[model samples]
Target chain A: MTKHFVSDTLVLLGRSLRHISRSPDTIITTAIMPIAFMLLFVYVFGGAIRTGSDRYVNYLLPGILLITVASGISYTAFRLFLDMKGGIFERFQSMPVARSSVLWAHVLTSLVANLISLVLVVLVALGMGFRSGAGVAQWLAVAGIMMLFTLALTWLAVIPGLTAKSVDGASAFSYPLIFLPFVSSAFVPTESMPGPVRAFAENQPVTSIANTIRDLFAQQQVGGDIWIALAWCVGLLVVAYGAAMAVYHRRTG
Target chain B: MSTDPQMTAERVRGPVIQVRGLAKAYKELHVLRGVDVEVARGSIFALLGSNGAGKTTVVRILSTLLKPDAGTATVNGFDVATQAARVRESISLTGQFAAVDEILSGRENLVLVARLRHLRDPGGIADELLARFALTDAGTRRVSTYSGGMRRRLDIAMSLIGDPPVIFLDEPTTGLDPQARLEVWQAVRELARQGTTVLLTTQYLDEAEQLADRIAILHQGRIIANGTLPELKRLLPPAKVEYVEKQPTLEDVFLAIVGDDGTDSTAGAASPAGTKNRGTR
Candidate 1:
């Protein structure tokens, strides 16, 4: 059974990846929004914002990366919605392949596609004079945290994917997700905000994540922020995964 | 439409699909009310019904895609509810809609299914099935580019990848052209000839007459009539034979006027005009 699950997931993942390759536009479209934000912020608003740092692009890069992931995962929900509408889900359910493999394939596809979009955003940031002096270990840690965040958000997208009645409804849930980074430390530091806004910024999952990545890139003092970010990522991932699986079982069973 | 008595007798001796008191309700609306069905091995069984008469609900339950709210159903001797995986291994379902992935090429769709079924050579199996369905020419193109008939054929070809003994077709010819519908009927007949048990649901009375060894009429969530076509016809009032021969149906007139080459040139021309009008709207 485990073997079948692995094989089935790999096969279906190949199918999804083929879809990505054929329509490279989905990735391009996903990356375009975050890149536009990055360009607009780093160039237009860079000088106005005071972060006490030489380059505003460096401070904004981590936040932009998060936005990229948020926008990219909506496509996951959209694709899942299309599959459900197309009756392919029913087809897969009636087959002998492992049941959970269908969900795993979509989740993993979201991970891969989002990773590519993140890399593109980072490359664009580098072209715009955004630099990171972090060591290999620090870079690996950043990648790990980004992957965890993506997994959490992708699982969150699965809920609307499985249950939404319309295509717009399935993807519209990500609007709040894309807006979350703006309320956090992604753009301006929490210190610059009022008491209430700063408190909210400091407490949400995105701020801790953005601060951790920004600090790592700047080679700042290591703090307890890493643990908080990991806790948030892991917590959301567990809850979303559990809920998505419950919905899947209820829908298919 | 002629059914051999010896073949029917042999098929009656062993049933491949059995359902007893199968019932399902969606909240307040009862969809299937105590439906019972038995499909003999190596025979074609058609469940006939009108729209919203619970034909699809029965198919969903028997194929293990949906669970029955009450009673038991088995496929290939495996309980559909408890042994779903085992039953899935022995059966394939081609749903009302052509379930092939639109993004993938016809060849890619077949290869994907074949690989999932753990076939030795997915490429070879895909090629063989594509050729068998006469989709080899369109195999290289993405399914989104294929016509409706081609898509339906590919859907059935995908279901045959594992060579499962039992196949469930839910309204297989629902939206197809007359020529395409005939082709699908021929394919279903060929499956039963090879000792594969076929359970198909249809709303067309002629489709049941053309393909089924036994027909069950499901009306308002109940099997109101079940028997061989001859027996079922016997239950109706005897037809009055006139001295003049009966005329051909309107369908025959339409087919004759449109040409039966299976290309459906009139529809081909008419559909583009229809789309143009819709586009303007």
Candidate 2:
């Protein structure tokens, strides 16, 4: 069964990757929103917003990457919802293949697709005069954080994908995630916000993650914020994966 | 629709599927209650019912897609509840909807299933099924572009990969037009002829009448009637012969008007191969 799970997941992963490749629009749309936000923030809102950074795009890129993944995972939910509604999910379940391979395939596909969109967003950031002096290790750390954040969000998206009744409901959960960066240091310093809003923003997962990635890109001395970001990503991944599996078992059991 | 006597004797060899006191409920709604069914090997068994009669529930349970609340069911002698993996190894399900990947081409869908089943030479299996289903030309095209009949045919073709001894088709012809319906019926008949035990659910009485070796009527979550078509016919008053004009059904007129060649190009190529395959079996 374990062996079949590996092979079956690869087969189904190829199937969904084909879906993404055939319609490149899903990837473009995922990147488009973050790119537009980067442009608006760095060009439109950059002059007035004071983050003490030499280039505003440098500070803004981290939060924008998070938003890109937030938006990209909605497509993950959408694809899973389509499979559920179309009855293809059940078709796979009824077959001789390992059952868990069905969900794993979608989750891995989300990772691959989101990574591409993240790369696209980063490329756009570079074009917009965002430069990082970080060496290979720092860049690797940033990539690692982003991939962890993407995996955590993707598992969270799986809940709505399995349980939502409508396509709209499946994807609507991401709006708050996209909105989260706005309240954090993604746009401006949390110190600029009112007391209550600042408290919420500081305590949230996005602020720690964005701050850590930002520091990494600038090649600044590592601080405890790295631990917090890792904690947030790992914590959310565990909780979301547990909840998604619970929902999966409840529905298919 | 003649019953092959040799296959009938083969059926007596054993029941490929068996169920006893099966029951299932979704919260407040009781979908299936104490349902019992037995399907002979190498025969077509139709679970005949109207919508909301829990025919799908029964199929879901047998396929191990859903668990039953009570009693037991088995496929190929393996219990559905405990030996689900073994049961899955011997059975395939073509759901009410055409459960296919719309983004992938017809050939890709076939190959996907073959690979999932861990069969060697998935490409060969896909090509063979594509040719058998008359989908070779559309094999490279995405399924979303195919006509309803063509999609259903592809769906069934995917299920035939690895030739599992038992197959389940839930409402295989529910949404199809007359010509597509005939095409599906041909596919179902062909499966039984190849020594596959088939369990299909259908609301259409004529579908049961035309295809099943034995028909079980499920109504209000229970099996209300179960027998061969002739045996079930015996339950009613015998027909008294009287002179009456026989009028052609709308289906016949439709088929005649549409031309026996079939409006869909892939439709005309299936029958001859179907006959040839049946003869060899």
Query: lDDT per model, in order?
Result: 0.86, 0.87
Backbone N/Cα/C clashes per model: 0, 0
Clashing pairs for model 2 are none
lDDT of 2 by residue, B167-212 (tens): 9999999999766776788888778777788999998777787789
lDDT of 1: 0.86
lDDT of 1 by residue, B1-33 (tens): 133435644533557898999899999989999
Query: Candidate 1's residue-wise lDDT over A78-192, tens digit each?
Result: 9999999888888888888898998899999999999999889989888999988999988998899999999999999999999999999999999999999999999998889
Ten contiguous residues minimizing lDDT sum, candidate 2 chain B? B239-248
Which candidate comes out best when scored by TM-score?
Answer: 2
